[model samples]
Target: MKNDNVILGIDLGTSAVKCVAMSTSGGIVATTEAAFPLTRDLPGQAEQNPADWLTALELAVTRLGRDVTMNAVAIGLTGQLPTLVCLEGAKPLPSAITWMDSRADAWASSFLDDSKRQMMYDRTGMPIDGRYLAPMFRYHRETFDNGVGTILSAKDFLHFALTGELATDPSTAAGYGLYDLDGANWSQELCAVWGISSSLLPTVRPSASASGLREAVAARLGLPSGLPVTVGCADSVASAYAMAGLDSGTVCITSGSSTIIMDSLPKPLRDSQRRYLLTPHIADGVFGREMDLLSTGTSYRWLNDLLGWENGRIDIAAARSQAGANGLLFSPYLAGGEQGALWNPNLRGVLHGLTVQHSSDDIARAYLEGVQFEIRRCVDILAEDSKIERVVLAGHAASHSATMQMLADILGRPVAAYHHRSPAAIGAALLAAPSAAHSKQMPTDKAVAVPSQLRADYEKIYRRYCAMFPAIAEAAD
Candidate 1:
């Protein structure tokens, strides 16, 4: 690989599309982002037009400048998962149902009995949830009384728009809730359970598989025609590839709108409690064991808006309060349900022990602590099977030293903050780079350590949070 050549990684996120250019020498040449609005008017609904993703991609690449845009190199793609995109021919039907949507929660709760749910978890390694693509598709058809068409994941839809290919990678396939984890293919039995035809889904391909860029899109984006484009994995998978690269036991938490706690496993490991999700990793012979917290970053943003405080103010306010938030406890389940270490969809956010003495700063601190408590729950589960040798934090929210320190204090372990704004985008770029260049070391911020004096307080707080959770969940039930 020539040092001058650069690979382009386009990451379609929950709210925007981010593009990054990386040289063969493993340095980021340039980066740009374009935001897109998420539709949330309807209750228990979250959606976006697939067309918006393409527009954002074009806007992002155009912002990359002509020189970087025209750079002679391959392209790779990554994006959020389980976002159902229905298409007729090559055009999207209407809106793509995102992972956060919970319209099928009621149906999933009623239709999937305990026996059936266990069977699903055994087959697909996914807890039977309404947020998955299969259930979401079922809900879409029944509610709208619409006829069926082709089905695709969010990234697959983007890939088709970019290269005119109708295919999906394995990591994305797992999001369908019909993919057989053991067989590494779509499970007919599981599909039968949902009354879905496998033919509707795109053909599964390898994450690093390559396809030629469509000449029309190339001309539109000012890039070379027929450029090699790599079909990438899910955003979480891509970030894991960049940060750890098949190195088992190194857990990486990519915190964005949600926080995904994941690590590589040489073989699939199932949790008897079905707390974590097991899926295909970025490459063959590797599996991704992950648990997602659906409301970590979302809670922060919601609190900021509610308080009319700017972005970083919450973190600074959190720093003003001590470890336990002055006896206040917050449950960061603002996303209507919880995922990491808990699969209860009935759960909602709770503010416990609030008092007149409590200030906005205390609330902010408690919310941050609540998120860390959830992460600790996940980390504890991950450690149950394998020792967590290292904890690396990545994503938009990973750069905050104070927040990262709080996490370290909660987990009683050093947490290394990845020194990148978008690890998923960089990981996608790495997928396009040559195998030799994959060895480039990912830069990380200094590890945050738990203060010695506060260890006892942190431990006590974690215990109290754990004790309070079952009662809270029981009430929701």
Candidate 2:
């Protein structure tokens, strides 16, 4: 007989809430999604109301309740990391400071000294970025009164709202820039320097362990009271899980609002160059993953908006016509910037080699290539040890184009796309299911793209692009 109890996975994304219920056998019994608007009051400000997330969560669970069994075994929650939310006695005081927001750049620069910052990177495996919690915390302290009760990320706040639990998993805490990657805990010294209180932060927990559900929340969702809720992970980590735990020498790529490249390591790997971030795996002490975040899909969206593409309707024929793009090149740093080079908030988008001969198709193709080039840079940095064996691509953008195949050829590696449409939600479901302790079934993978025969053609173009990086950097300077 099938397991009577089901596992529920809730993903609180930047623009949507995705929920899934799964049988112990890894079958998806029910799935639901609800979307909310991401508001931008100013050019650099991206904000979302916390109430919208709560509403979406309620709606998604209610939608799921319409079809499937209600005896949920456990609930696992995931969300975009580093977005900050301030709360006063469980009430949100302001809109969430989204991960894309760059308002804290000056604040981050003011508080984090160079030596201390390097120590932080050594301890946390994360380079200093304005989006991290410590920077935003400093911004809040300088701008707001100290009386505000606590500040939490979007996921941590949602976890508390659902189960009255004040806790975070290592996966989410890793993005805070204060959590010690080596120590596997929040660094009191770092927090003190930023004038943050340790008491305001949630307790760190294992990503898959039980977080007892609260009665009030249970009644609202029609779930059984006292049910177990798994401590959730960062959405990227959850996606990694859904694809399959990073085996020895494997990497995962997710192209969303930003591009995230992650690879599993047997132990914490600190880069003296600080090219990428290392964080504890969601699966406890079993592993760690390194991350590189850059603006990839955001560049695509920028082009679409510029060309008046409505409803995500892209002219596929036009896009393909300009594959080589007549030697056009673009630097996709539209929304601030990230990664090892030029971590500048002031960096703007640039389109090089533009001329009257170049068409919209050329611009579009160049945009795609630009993003792929950035991905290749990160991959090269992470592959220094020659440990990466395979590459798995996930996320909506990865599914949308032949662009990924070009990326594979450029990297000289085969790329496989997993079947799971929303890997993060699927991974959340896997995390929620305690049956993994007793059963042997695991998530499966399906390939959507592979290495193209035109590897040599793409390589030539890739080298030309690589050769242009120094010039591009100089131009940006």
Candidate 3:
């Protein structure tokens, strides 16, 4: 590993494109980001033009400085999963349907009955829903007068833009709700059920498999021509790999707009309750039992806007408020549904026990605590199968030490959070590196210990939260 050698990692996130240039020796050379807009004009709609991702990627790469871009040894790709992008030849449709969109919910709800859903879950390890690519495509076909040419996820589109390859890694392909975990290939029956053709789907490849970059695309980004680009796994998988490798004992929670709680397993492990998603992991032969919180940082950001406070002020106010938010319990399901811990798609947000004594600070604190309580529930579920030796936090929510401490107190264990930039991108960079050099990419992390004083109070609140969730959720529904 030389200091000059670098790997370029790009993450086409929900909100923006985050790019990181890291040396094979584990040092971050440079980082840059380019923001893009998410359109939500209609009900249950969330979309972005596919062109925006490529534009953002080029802009982000240009900001990485010419020297760092030129010295890159390889490029790695990772991003949000299940974002459906339709490509007609080399051009994409007007907009790409993001994972956050739920316009297909009605179709999804009515399409599969209990027996069919159970069969799909047993075979695919994914609790199929409207947010998945197959459902979105079905909805698109029925409503719009467009012909289906090819289907690709967000990162796969980026990979095609850069390397002229129409392929997806297993981790991302699993999000389509058609990949068979046992067969390790696309399920033709499931595809027919969704009315999606197998030929329209992208080819599945290993996450770290490489393709040569297109000369024209490389020239536009000011990088070396014909550089190898590795189509990495989902952002959640990359985040998990960045902090804790493919080991089984560690749980990695990426708390961003949405929170992903996952633990890798040597083989496929399905939940009897079907509460968690079983997906392919960073590489072959490994799988992840995963749970996702639909809204975490999104709730925090919503509160910031509602309260007219700055971005980081919510953490300060949350820290000041006493434990339990003075009995004001908040259900952080502002996303109209939840994924893990409770797989109820009709569930809505609830702010229970609000009275005159509750102030904005209390509301903020309650919501912050609410998110961690949800994480605690998912953690407990993961702990059923794995020992959970350590918990690692990544993404934007890990920046606030006070909130991290609150999480630690709620979970009753120390959590190591990477306070640096995007761990997913760094993880992708490590994947892009030579296989033998992957060990060098584990960066330093900050450990937050549980505070004894708050632990007791959170314990009581957590119990009450667990007891009150069903009633509140039912009422809210």
Q: Estimated TM-score per prediction?
A: 0.97, 0.92, 0.97
In model 2, the runs with Cα more than 4 Å from the true position are 1-4, 110-113, 310-319, 340-342, 437-448, 474-477
Instruction: In model 1, state the lDDT of residue 216.
Output: 93
Candidate achieving the largest lDDT? 1
The residue-level lDDT of candidate 1 at 6 comes to: 83
Per-candidate Cα lDDT values, in order, are 0.87, 0.74, 0.86
Between prediction 1 and prediction 3, the one with superior lDDT is: 1
Error of 3 at 37 (Å): 0.6
Q: TM-score of predicted model 1?
A: 0.97
Candidate 1, superposed: residue stretches over 4 Å from native: 1-3, 143-147
Off by over 4 Å in 3: 1-3, 444-446, 475-477
Clashes of 2: 1
Q: Clash number for every model?
A: 0, 1, 0
Count of clashes in candidate 3:
0
